[model samples]
Target: MGGPSREMTVMRIPLKKAKHHFGASLSRGTRPYNEDAYQAGTIDIPAFAKRRPISLTRNPKGEIKNEVTPAGSSSGDPQVFYFGVFDGHGGNECSGFLMEELHKYIEDAAKDFELESSLQIKGPVHRYIGWSGSAEVDEQMPASGSAPETTAEESLGAVKTYTPSGTESMKPPKPGSKHDGPTPGAKSRQSPLSSAPPVKQSMSVRKAEDLERELVMDWKELVGGYFRRFKPEWFSMSAGGRGHPAEQDVIAKRHYPNSAVPNEAVEGIGIETVLQYAFLRADYDFVSAQVGKRDEDPVLADRAINDDDILGHPSRGGKSIGGTKRFKGGSTCSMALVSTPTPTPFWHPAAPSTVVTAHVGDTRIILCKTATGLAVPLTSNHHPSLPEEATRLRRYAATFVTDSFGEERVSGLANTRAFGDMQSKRIGVSAEAEIRRIEVTSAEYSFMTLVSDGVSGHLSDQEIVDIIKEAQTPEQAARDVTSFATEVSADADNATTLVVRLGGWERRTEGGLGSLGTKELRDWRKAEAENPRGRM
Candidate 1:
């Protein structure tokens, strides 16, 4: 967490080379105290290639009960992987919330999808399954309300229908008569009287459309559900346990569309959805929690002065933090919800996996192409001044003002979207995700990077990619990136980076200056010229 102290730590983990793939992270440096965090790991989800047994419970007489539980949740996997980076501003509380809760929210969203898929067997729009809460949820309060639900029968009922009698055009001609008999020299007759009925959509297409809309809504519910539930309780304590979260959602990345599109691309929709869900839901919780705060000022003030480190660091003592700030802080989230290639029963199980990414600030995730050693940015910065973004704010009813650098900020926010900045949320500053999906290919993918604005603000993506390409190992690559950024990039705030290598990476063992302390430039260049590309 970044705050007063400028301390940092560094370490490495060695995995068995022959079997397990290697993974590593380096967070050892100070960036305005480093309020950024990263997570790179694997999680298990259900196998959707085959239909799962739905009636999972038994009755008193030992007979199977008719259960309507959703189908999702696989026991085995080549394994699902997750990679994320949270950049915090105003303070770390918001980022901390993301570091701890984002993945759970995504997983829960998956379950909601499975449940909806199962629910389609019964009447569709008539019955809403699971929990229904305060109008605050259904209405989403300051946010947009959900679209109206509809069943297949109801939605398709409007499509035109025709009888098999084929209108007035299908009059059967007498056998071997003028209509059926081809008179050798006779001109074709009476064809102008026959015409086909207007085209109507097939039942298959209508059903698919219904499923598509339902899946979209289910995703909205699952993606942001956890963020909505956890932010308030953790902030105020009284709201500790509100939403019912016993069962979790298991979000499938590219595969498992079930009865949806038969031949879909490997990557899912791009740039914006659930990731926005997280930020908005968090803000709603924070804003909603602010109620009665003024009346409870005495209690908050006493707690703050006595607990100076309240909003920031856990070890330091700036104790009187958010008391003055009123906890009106926020965090920028840039994460890649990755579903890596695994053995699945779903179509194209042999095909590659896809990445669904979302962000609400300057944090970035760039994919480096290994074959050519080039940087492929996964997302553009979400700032109000970025052309379309500027237009978007105006359309969304958000106000923007030019900062000292002439960049646009929604309500003075550096980025267009974020979590928990109650002030920012009121204007056009939205948590709505600009979603995007990128298909992960074989050797074309080198590394997918996640970094806060602190690091990105100074180092260019190409520069970062070059550093990564030249480093000896993952940990070494991260160290080189941040150290170079701080020692040279000139930015002052916290700095952190996470790297995911698509292929194997190895460490370098060579001789040179023990560290990158001051050295004569001419001699250093000579030494650099002498080393191979993989050595430094």
Candidate 2:
């Protein structure tokens, strides 16, 4: 947990030989209080090792009953590792919520995914809302009236079929077909088909799109349900733990297409999807919570308070700022979920793992390669300046202005996507996460660094990688990263760093800081030349 404390908080769990260990360091930097948080831990996945045999028994009426025994749980070490860094803007409430509860939601998602995978159980989405397993019916009804239950196939039938236009074909491009357009994250270049008519989505693709959209909506509403029940006030208490009314439909109506999903629910559930669910859920929860009772209070609805104003609220007593309670604000989220092979050693040189990352706003995750000592970005920041993001915002008629410093902002917010910021949500400031997956090999990658803008704003990706590379341990690396940020810039925002040592920890780096180290060596020589052996 992180807050406004002046002293930096550090946490680490040392493993044998320091392999596959993690460390987190958070500091207030030059700010009055810190609004950043980081969480690192392993999630327990039940390993069913044995099962009891089924038996037939006689009931009271002499009717034969079939009895099935549940599988026995194995007490094995948890395999899935979660590491994240949250940069809070308005206050620590959003980040705090993420720190305290986001992992639980992720765990639940994982459990549900596993259940679906093993037992082929397609549990109702309502099970997630308010943590109610018995609540099967969608509490959220249609605007017209309550509708009868329908299967996924039936739901697909209700959606309109899409037809292709121009040269577009319903079938996917043939294998090995050359694509003139640049790949994702590649430098934008002019393409011959840039001006071609847009291809329409096929019905199968549209069905997947609808499924994905509904999943997102359901997760968001689930989080919103928890938020609605959070307040101790009479009205909220009387509401009896329900999600926001009509808000779910409002979000569903939004035209955000191409959020594609594989039609197979069981097989399609992956770590990337789980990460997205966690992020979207938390974002919706925080922002929807702030809008509570806003209609009754004009000030709350019409005027939003900055972090400082919220901290200096006259009603507050002598307590320090950046505590958990907050009305409004937002935070950028960057997280890495590592799925280690079950029953196999993790972070071992022999073990290969997959890292699935979810990111929103400017917070970032980078992997340090052992061979080149280079920083490989795992996530891209969601800034308004990005051409794709700018176009997306414009599609929703949202406006952004470039500051005198040339930083693009959406309604005075630096991040185009983040958690909370209720007002910004209306203008297409989305909580939809950008997800990426990578396979990690112990021989190639050394470790990963998750950092907030406080450090990233001042330090280059390679510089941060170099700083961490020079440290002897993950804890030291995390501390040095935050400390070096403030040393480089006194006015750095709340600095935080999370270093997770991979299987290739402490491997010799050929780069060895290269120019960065050369500059230091040059400076040291110059200093020695200027001063005599014992001169003071």
Candidate 3:
């Protein structure tokens, strides 16, 4: 007999270990605090109140991958001092994501030519929806009550097969053995082992088809709901300026819940909303300052007036400095995309060519001016009561005053308008914020600090300004504010701060005091050599 016939079998083996390496560190738990219980806490709230000329930046302890640069001063582009403090609710993920991606999104939006085109597009993009066909009913029917039975041959064919050792190939069966099966047409029939019946294998292809149809239907409903809820508000150039067209006339409106009622008003009301609005306003404000056309002759004339030369100077001959209008209170987000004007081939003193656009968000923005002494603000509160916020809050009959949130008086939340929490809007929360443009003169250099309620909640605006003012740089200012809030706040929530300082101005350097660098380095080397096992 031929040596046991050769055959091959393949087996799959799974690996025992996962192939990914995740790098992460555990953060220490925050110090506990009780809101219902009041304990005295001391912060150096007024240490920096005396005006001082200084520059600083503060970064919280972490690994940051982005470049933090001071806004530059150039003739062509307006330098922007960008800052923000993000207060987190629910979890830290949202706040962290905002810090990492907010600027990128803004920059990307700024560069999109399609955005400009979309603004000019007249009509809405109409979408056509359709449904799929349903399963057809069978035309022919089987007799009364019995289900179909499987044939013997078909049942036998469904039985599983196994190979025996020493038999490389499978054969149908032997003629008379107990384990052997007989051919259907043979003279002597041999039964299968133990006379067991064969099992039937069923393929329910129709059931699978039914499930797929249901899934498709569910998906269609989901898509429809998504579109209905998030209908896009296409861009429009006509919507520029604060209170220009007025808040009531704007097509967009916020619907509130029927149950919400205004009780005791709050102080520093709408602080978060105001800060956010201000930051966006700063962006627009600075952009307008840099690019808005003003006749050079008039600006010179205004500057030329002095105690003795008032009569000799010509009356300011140019039109008033034009800027984008302030927004009404209820508006949440704004965008403007304008084409840069072409420079005149020949210098025309009368024609000033520049393009400026402005946009605003509901929360805060940071602005830093390096040219002037630091002036701390009372608080960067953006509560609804400010004139800029009035129009936005009119629809809801909402007013910013002490006790907005029941009895809590110093609710640091400022802006009446912001993104997220649609439910709040239903309860008379307005999402509108004002946007304005203010010129930055040679005597005035300023940086903006934008933050959400998270940071503002625990610290006053002046306190924040003071902290930033004391720091050596804008980055340090931001980090210090965050750290201080984290150290002091009674609540456990997300907090963030952005500090943008103006650059291109000259200031005295600390290094100018003396040349002790070599001596310090030498001392460090000697100390390290002596210690040998030092950790530094």
Best TM-score among the predictions, by candidate number: 2
Model 2 gets an lDDT of 0.53
Off by over 4 Å in 3: 1-85, 92-391, 397-415, 427-433, 441-443, 452-454, 488-493, 504-536
lDDT per residue, candidate 3, 177-244, as tens digits?
Answer: 46422111101111111211111111122332233233223323433322122111111112222211
lDDT of 2 by residue, 1-536 (tens): 43432123223343323433667788898789899998876655432111111123312211111211122223332245678898988778778777777788766644544422211122443222212222222332112332233232332233222222331211222336574211222121111111111111111222333434555455445444323223211011122211122223323433347522222211122344444555665666566556542334545434444433554564353232223244567778887776542222334443445676777888878886655555678766677767767876776677789899777788898888888776676666666776665755434577888999888876657667777777778888888888877665545689889988775564624433432532353233235335665134
List the lowest-lDDT window of 10 residues for candidate 2: 192-201
Instruction: Give the TM-score (vs. native) of candidate 1.
Output: 0.53
Local distance difference test, candidate 1: 0.43
**How do the residues 1-536 of candidate 1 rate in per-residue lDDT, one tens digit apiece?**
44332112211222212112323344434544556766655434322111111222322111112212121225433344566777777667667777776776655534432322211223321122212231212321121322232222332232222222321211223545555212110111111111111111011322322333443344234443223222211011122221112111112222456523122211121112223334444445454444314533656556644464544556353422223435667777776655432332111112234566666667777765433344466666766656766766676466777878766566767777676666555454545554555644323354566777666775556556656656655566776666665554323457777766553122111111111211232223334345565143
Better of 1 and 3 by TM-score: 1
Lowest summed lDDT window (length 10), candidate 1: 192-201
How many residue pairs clash per model? 32, 0, 84
The CA lDDT at 387 in model 2 is 76
Q: Which has the higher TM-score value, candidate number 1 or candidate number 2?
A: 2
Clash-forming residue pairs, model 2: none
Clashes of 1: 32
Runs of candidate 1 exceeding 4 Å displacement: 1-32, 44-74, 115-279, 290-326, 343-351, 504-536
